[model samples]
Target: MQYSPDSDPSYDLKIHAGFKVVRDYSFSFDKVEISFKDMVRFIFPSTGYLIFNLFFGDDFTLRFLNYDLSEDLPHHLYITGLLSRGMLITGQQGTGGGYAMKIHPVIGYHFLRIPMYQLTDRQVRLSHIFDREGRPLRQLEANASARTLNDPGVKGFFSKYLPDKSVYLRDPVYHAVNKIISKKGIIQVKKLATECCMSERTLHRQFLLKVGLSPQSYAKIWQLHFTMELLKNNPGAKLQGIAFKAGYYDVAHLARDFREKLFVPPSQFYRDVNPMMQSYLDFPDSLQ
Candidate 1:
């Protein structure tokens, strides 16, 4: 059931662009300890699965907050949901070694039998809900911290944990979700439901089960994400043009989304943000 590393195109450089921003860790599949570098702050949006972080760094302080974007207090080792608003992660940048991977949202619940609601929009630790399973997950973290990152070990781990193509194809909602993503969240819920050959209520329920978010909310997330991406990529382009291209009614509409999701106006965010940091959080290298 294991997938060959060679079969998949390399996403390492893209996924860990922030680490690369700070310093270059040449790609190598010989061992698991991917690198020894200082960690930087990056905010990962709910675009995909939960990422596993096994850091062996000193003075590491990780925290997760709600959609409220409160930085007053933060908790270490946070568990995020499919509709997780956003996360602001900060850590010391120094001698660290680790292995990390993104676990598909559906696979996490399907194979692990984790309830999506428990993690939805809440900022808590893996131990909170994974009470009995926490010990093993923590042990896995320990194991990951100890070993050097190698191709075989990484491939073996994913093959054991990730759902196969059959599982994805078997789910009816998967196709619907794919349709929404293909349109970049520019489609309507009713149309999506019709395309999926289901009623709106059924589509809502199915999306919640498979994606941990209502279809409307899921679409909004991608809309905002795409808008942000447009702004980031088109510096010389006019804001109005970007807004229209992103399917927003107007520049004000786009700004509203920016405020809601990023906790800042587009102008302020663009001025203060670092391109490298955004590349890490928003998406992979090519897309960013």
Candidate 2:
């Protein structure tokens, strides 16, 4: 199906990665996008489009083929879980103004409960990629998708639970801190406290009450998350170069961190873990 941005009143005002991807039918079968981290996604409700999940986000989808989003008007969203991988296999569309956030699955789930914070990111297995259920979970393939906004199967899932104004009580703290992490990879706790205009103890408290993981842990996660991204883009980059770019002091430090998070060293093989190069080949302009 074709997708254009939603112009209605209820949709999330933010856009994400606005770009056009042209598919050459004779030269190629399909163009695919794959990402491991969280990313902002949008679809125009006026146009019927199925937003397919490419990686770690769509663990609980029920249906895989012939899904519809035209009826999903009020723009429902949720803080999605950490997807092992992510992919989008479908027709062309336009979207903009969003990026991948650093929040972990545990912390992200809490954000879903907030009303004003519609985790617009969704997980859906594409029919073309995986036949039946999209990906396997707990030994078997998972068979669920975020129910359509107006779908009878799960109507009002977001409305019935999330708050009306803002779902997060610590919105200011989380927003400011996360913004810093986005730009700086790793940040000191004391510096984070000052940046948010809150005390050190208060920052820790807010993190605990709202998000289960501590701030330091979250930063480390984002650090490695960024590392994975850097490795993906600069495939020829050596360990030290990748380390410095991703905010590490040396190659050993980078290797240790990679092992701690992904259970493998940087030299082992990241491409085998995920098809990073092929995904980039799909969007040459963006990579350039």
Candidate 3:
């Protein structure tokens, strides 16, 4: 599951009692959904990409981007910027069929050309930034509903939007980010700055510019991510063992970190929902 810059993610399909998560890497698409459940809340961490959601049904009302409970965004395509952390709560889910595309971190900046740090933990209409004309995801969503679009069509859609790689795309900061992700956020921030031959302040600036989070913040989130992965894959593993393996000093240390980041203990966090979907969608093994 090692991912090079060009590597597409591996896929996995998970079937819950009522909802199914199609973890397809076919079009750089992370997950597809056709929900039959009433409500599901998704807790997602930073994935360094702007997420495109081509929502097809009107039954589900998702409250994110600080939308009020009365707001209903139906039959529209939504775009979420690089999130530091966020929650998606679906109200009255019946048929929320959709396609999700993970826009490359660099390409997001290239297209928007704005400070990504400002976009952290927010959502906007994709049409608002790129506009409705020549909207690829909207077209794909239509075709998908009609059973006219295949995997190749999805691939072609993204190929059209791939950004030209500038020096920043291949810079040391980019490499350092990948290295930290590869090690499951276990690597030291000081070591990463040294390897990139930049001062710690410079490293932080680059990360905020490119990935919308400081390296320290991303690393902490990734540690929680790794812990979740371990829990999902090895349900029988002891809490103490999982914590230590995920780079926490002990179970208490892990608990405190989880409380600060997730606002819940690990056990309570995993009790209500399937962690697998979030894990696969957010921190796929290829990127890890």
Candidate RMSDs in order: 10.0, 15.3, 8.7
Backbone clashes (count) for model 1 = 11
**lDDT (Cα atoms) of all candidates against the true structure:** 0.52, 0.38, 0.58
- Residue-by-residue lDDT tens digits, candidate 3, 1-288: 111112232322332222212233223444345454444444544454567655556564455434223333554555566655434333324565555566555456665666677667766665455555337656654554322124444445445554555634666766786787689889888889999999899998988897788888777766777887787678888998999899988999999877766667877666654443454355322211
User: How accurate locally is residue 245 in candidate 3, as Cα lDDT from 0 to 100?
Assistant: 95
Poorly placed runs, candidate 1 (over 4 Å): 1-48, 65-79, 83-94, 97-100, 122-157, 282-288
Point out the higher-scoring one by lDDT: 1 or 3: 3
Q: What is candidate 2's local distance difference test score?
A: 0.38
Candidate 2: regions farther than 4 A off: 1-150, 165-170, 275-288
lDDT digits (tens) for residues 163-248 of candidate 1: 45577667767677667667778998898888888999998987777677888888787677777678778878888898898898
lDDT of 2 by residue, 1-288 (tens): 122222322222221233321221011112223221222232111000112222212321212112232211111222222212122222222221112212322223342333211222233222212233222221121233332322332223222322332433346654644554565447778887887788988877666544434566556655765777688778888778888888888989888766555556776535454222233222221210
Better of 1 and 2 by TM-score: 1
Q: Rank the candidates by lDDT, best first.
A: 3, 1, 2
**Which candidate would rank higher by TM-score, 2 or 3?**
3
